[model samples]
Target: MKEPYEKPLIKKVQVGLSNKFGSVYGRHLRPEIDGVPISDLVSRFGSPLFVFSERRLREKYRQIYQMFSTRYPNVQFSWSYKTNYLDAICAILHQEGETAEVVSEFEYEKARRLGVPGSEIIFNGPYKPLSALKTAVQEGAIINIDHFDEIYDLEEIAEELGQPIKVGIRLNMDTGISPQWTRFGFNLESGQALDAAKRLVSGGKLILNGLHCHLGTFLLEPRAYAKAIEKMVDFAYELEDNFDLKIEYLDIGGGFPSRNRLKGIYLSPEVAVPPLEDFAEAICDTLLSKLKPNDFPKLILETGRAIVDEAGFLITTVHASKRLPDGTRSYVVDAGVNILFTAFWYNFKIELEEDISGPAEPCVIYGPLCMNIDVVAENVQLPPLPRGTRLIFSPVGAYNVTQWMQFIRYRPAVVLVGEDGQVDVIREAENLNDVVDRERLPERLILKKS
Candidate 1:
C-alpha cells in the first residue's frame, strides 16, 4: 500500500524578522461572541456572515455618553449614519437617546422612516438637493450649510417660504493636522467664515443657530480636537459680540479614531489609539476653560466609528489553501474587499475560531473574487488553516456595511445578537433576484439575443 497521503510541505530556514513580529495568534483568543459559538453561528446564519453585538453597541454608547456628559453639561451625541446605517444598529443608538446625523437624502429618509423626528436629525454634507432641503426645512431638521451656493440657495428658500430659516455654517479651519479638510466649508483663517455668518445674519434671511467644523476622520491626536474646539468657541463668542447672535450649539464633527490598526501601522491599535476618556478630557478641558459658565453652548458630537467599530465582527470561512512558488502559505476566504472595504486601508484583526498549535508561517489572505486586488491581509503570521476553518475579522462595524460594493458576489446577511443572546437578521442576504430586479433591459434587447 502507498504511504498515507499528506499535504505537501516545505522546510525553510528562518531569516530576518522573528515570527513574534507578524504572528497575531496565541496572544489573542476568540472562542465565542456573546456566548454564541462560531461554529453555531456559521451553521445557523451561513458562512461569511456579518455579526453585530447589541450589548457592546449599548455599552460603547453608554461609555462614550458618560465620558462626555459627566465632563460637559448639555452634551449630546448624534449617531453618524454614514458609519453604519443598519436599521438595527441605528435603532439601538437612537434608543440610547442619541439623535441622527445624516449626510444624504437617503439617510435622511431612513432616519424619518425609523421614527426619528426631523427636528432631532442633523442634516449634514456638501450636497443637499432642493427637494431634500425643502423636506428637511419643513421637518425642522438642522441643516449645516457647506458653501456660498448653499447660503444663496437657503436665502432663496427662506424668501420663497416667507420666513427666516435657521442653519449652521460649517467652518473650515487649520487645526494643525496634515492634509487639511478645507474643501467642505468656508475658510475661517481667510475670514470667509465670518463673512458667511454676516451674510446669513445681516441678510436677515437665514439665522445662524450653530457653528460646525469636521477636522478629519480617524484622527489619532485628541489635541487636534482641542484646537478645533478652541477656535469654534472663539468664533462663537465673536459672532455673539459682533452679530448679536446666540449660537445654540457647537457641533464638532466626528474625527474620533477607532481601535482598528491601519495597514502600514506596526503597533497594534490597542497600543496606538488613545482611550475614549482621553479624547473626552481633551475636548471638555478646552470647552470648560474657553466658555463662561452662563454661555456654555450645547456640545454636539458626531462620533461614529469609535462608537461602533469594536462592536461588529465579520465571520468568514476558509474555502481553500495553497502554497506559493516561494513556499508562502495563502488562504482563500469567503469574504473579501468587496464586503470589507476597510481592508484596503486597515489590517483588520482576525482570529481563528478553534485553538490549534503549529508552526506559524507568513500568510496572505485573499477573498474569493476573480480580481487580484481582493487581498484581505498581507504577510500575516498564521499557521496552516485547512479548508472550512472559521476566521473572525473584527472591528468592522463602522464602514464595511455602508461602503460595501455589490461586485462579483451578493452581499452577505447581517445579523444582530441582542442583549438576551437572541439572534435576528437585520439585513437579508441578497439573491439573484435582488440584483436583477433593479436592472432593466430594453424590450428590443430582450427580444433579440445579442
Candidate 2:
C-alpha cells in the first residue's frame, strides 16, 4: 500500500544574457572546467592577475613555424626577447627549437642564462654597449650592427680582441611607409647601406655574413614585405658581385600582427588582414624568384607579438558601476593602464564569464589607477555587470609583459598555465620591500629613532 501525495507548484525566474565578444562558447562565456574562471582565479590569486594559456601559446608558435617551414626549406624563428622575455616563456620556445633574438646587454645575458648557445642567438639592435659587443664576439653570436658608430666600435673591439667577429648590417629600405625611416639602420636608397658594407669589407676588421632589414612593426600590408625582400636580395647580389662575399642569412625583423583589432577599425576574423600564409608566400616567392640556388640564405624571422599574443589573458574584478551624466554606464576595474599599454593602440575585447539576466549597455572601462588616463576601454558594449563581477581581456601576451611599468601602483604576479592545466607563478607580485631593496637610505636621513 502507498500513501497519497500532493503536487507542489514551482516558480520560474527570467534571465537576460547576451554574448558581447562572440566567444567560442556560443552566446555566453562559461567557467572553464580546468582553466578556472575569472572570479575563482581572482579569489585565489587576487585581482589583476595575468593568466597564460599554454594551449594557445603552443598552437600559435606551431602555426608560425609551419607557415614558414612549409613554404621555405631553411626557416628559423629567433624569439625576440624584448617582446616577453619571461624565462618560462623563452624556455618553452627554446625547448620547441626556437632561437633567441636579443637587443641589449642585459637581454644577451638573459639568453646566455637560459642556456641558449651563442651560436643560436642573433643580437639585433641599434645601441649595443661595448661590453655587450665583447661578450657577443667572444660567444660567437651574430651581431647585427646598426649604424656607422656601431661599425667603428665593433672594429676597434675586434682589433683589440685580435679576432675577426662575424657581423651583419641592418638595412633600412624606404618602403614608403608611414613616419618614414627615422630611426635605426643605414638607408638603402641613400647608398648608406652599400657604403657601409663596402667599408666593412675593405677594412677587414669584421666578417660580413648577412643582411638584415626590419621594415616596421605591425605591418598591415604584405606587399611591403615583398618589396623589402626584393631589395634585400638585390643588395645581397651586389655584395657578392663587388665584395665577393657570400651572404649567409637574411634576417627579416618581426612586426607580425596579432588577432586583436586596432582602434577605430572593425575587422571580422574571417577577413584576414595579411594572414600568415600571405607573409610566407610573399617572402618565399620573392626570395625564390630572385636568388639562385647557391645564393639561398637562411631565412630568419624575429617574431614576438604574433607568437605570444593569444597566449595571455588579464582577469580583473569590477570595483564599481556607475551611470554618467548623459545616461551611460561605466564599470571601473581593479586593473589599469599601468599594466596594459596595448589598450591605447588596441580595442581590447572584454567578456564576462557567467550568464547574467541583464540588458547589454555601452560602457567605459576604467582601471584602478589614480590618473585620469587609466581608462582601458571606451564605448564598449558589455552586459550589465554588478560590483565584484569578473572581466577577462584577451590577446595581451606580447608587449604588455615586457613594456609594463610599475607606475603609481605595483604590478601583479604573472602565472604560466602549463599544458597539463597546472598553474605556476613565473613572476610574483611586487611588494614594498621589493621596491625598497633597490633604494638606498641616505646617511644624513638615517637618524636614531626614539
Candidate 3:
C-alpha cells in the first residue's frame, strides 16, 4: 500500500551565489512554506491551492504600521477590502487592529459580518447606491464622497435623517505620475476639488472632516507620495483658514506596490520598486513639515496590495508540456487566468517543487483555460518540468482572490499556513454543486431524461 502520509523531500534547485572567499556557486531550494512541505499540503488540501503565511501577514502589517507611527503621531491604516477580502485574510488584519476600507456594498457587508463595527469602516468607491449610503450613514461609517452626485445624494439622506452628516471628499491630482487617475474624484489642479468642497460645506447638511486621494496602484516612485501629501496638506490648511473646517484626517490612499515585476518593465523589480521605508520617508517628511506640530491631522493609509501581496502563494501542478513552432517550450498548468488573474499584469517568480536538473531554457507558461488569451508568462526561464511537477508562485496575495472568476472549472481551495506550521483550509475547492448552485432553470427548459 502507498504510504498514508508523504514524507518531506529535500529538493535541489540551481541558484547563483558568491562565497565568502569571493567565488562560489550552488543550488537553493525553497522546499517548504513556513515548514509545511508543498507535497504534503497538496496531498491534504487538493491542488491549485492558495497559501497565506500568518507570520508574514503579521510582519507586513507591523512593518508598515510601525514605519508610519514611529515617524508621525496618530497614524491609522484601513485594510482595503477589494484587494483580498478572504475572511481569513481580513480576520488576521483585523486581529492586527486594522479597520476595514471597502469599495462596494458586498465588501462593506463582508467587513461588518467579520465583526468590524460600522464606525471603524471607511466607505469609498464611485458606485455606492442610495440604499448603501443610507446603511453606511446610519452605521456611522466614514463615507468618502466620490462624485458631485454623491454630495446631493448625501444631502438628501441628511435631511431624511434630520441630522447633518460628517463626510470626506475624494480628490484626484497629478502627483508626477503618468496618465493621471482623473476619472475617480474631483481634480485638484483644475480647482474642481475646491469647488466641490465649497459646495459640500456650504450645503450645511454635510460636514467635511477629512480629505482623501488615491494615486494610481503599483506606484514605483516614492516621490509621488511626497507630492500628494504636500498638495493635500496645503489644501487642508486652506480649508481650515477659509471655511474654519477642522480636518480630522488626511487619507493618502494606498497605491504602495509589491515586489512583483510588471510586464514590459526594463528594470528589475528591485531596481523599479522602492522599499517600504522609502515610501514612509517620502510621506512622513512631507506631513511632518506641512502640518502643525501640535495639531496635525490623523494620517490614514488605505493600503491594500502592499500588506498582503508578498504573503500569498499559489501552488499548481504541471499537467502537459509542448514546444511552440518557434521552438520555445510551453507548459500548461492546472491554474489559469480564471484563478490567477494577476498573471495578466505580473511576471510572477515561479519555483519548482521537485528536482529538475537541466540547463534553463526560455519558455511560455499557459493556464488550463481553452482561450488563447490565457497565457500566464510570455517568456520565462525554467528547466523541463514533467507531469505532476509542482510550481509555486509567490507574492500573489493581493487581488487574485477578489478578482478571480469561476469560469470553465471550479475555483481552487485557499489555505492559511499558521505561524506554528498548522495548515487550515480557509476556502474549499469548488464542486459541481458549487458551480451550478446559483443557477436557475425554467420549467419549460428543463429537459426530460431519455
| Clash counts for all predictions | 0, 1, 0
lDDT per residue for candidate 2 within 1-450, as digits (tens), equals 563342332323222433444322223463552466566667767878888877788888999899889878889899999999999999999988899999998899999998999989999888898888888888888889899999899999989999888899998887767755548888899999999998899889988989898877777878878888999999988988998888999998988888788875665444535687888888989888998865568999999998998888888889888767666678889889899988898877676777766546567999988889998998676666877887778879988989889888889988887888788889899998877888988999998999
Per-model TM-score versus the true fold: 0.95, 0.91, 0.93
The whole-model lDDT of each prediction reads: 0.90, 0.83, 0.89
Q: Model 1 TM-score? A: 0.95
Candidate 1 lDDT, tens digit per residue, 1-450? 674464677667353454544534443468789998888888888979999999999999999999999999889999999999999999999999999999999999999999999999999999999889988998899999999899888888888889889999998898888989999999999999999988887788898989998988998988899999999999999998998889999999898988899866777788888898998999999999999777778999999999999999999999988778877789999999999999999988888888666677678999999999999999776776777888899899999999998999999999998999999999999999999998989877877558
The model with the greatest TM-score is: 1
Model 3 root mean square deviation, Cα atoms = 5.6
Residue 358 alpha-carbon offset, candidate 1, angstroms: 1.7
Candidate 3 contains a number of clashing pairs equal to 0
Candidate 3 lDDT over 118-234, as tens digits, reads 999999999999999999999999999999999999999999999999999899998889978888989999999999989997899999999999998998889999999999999
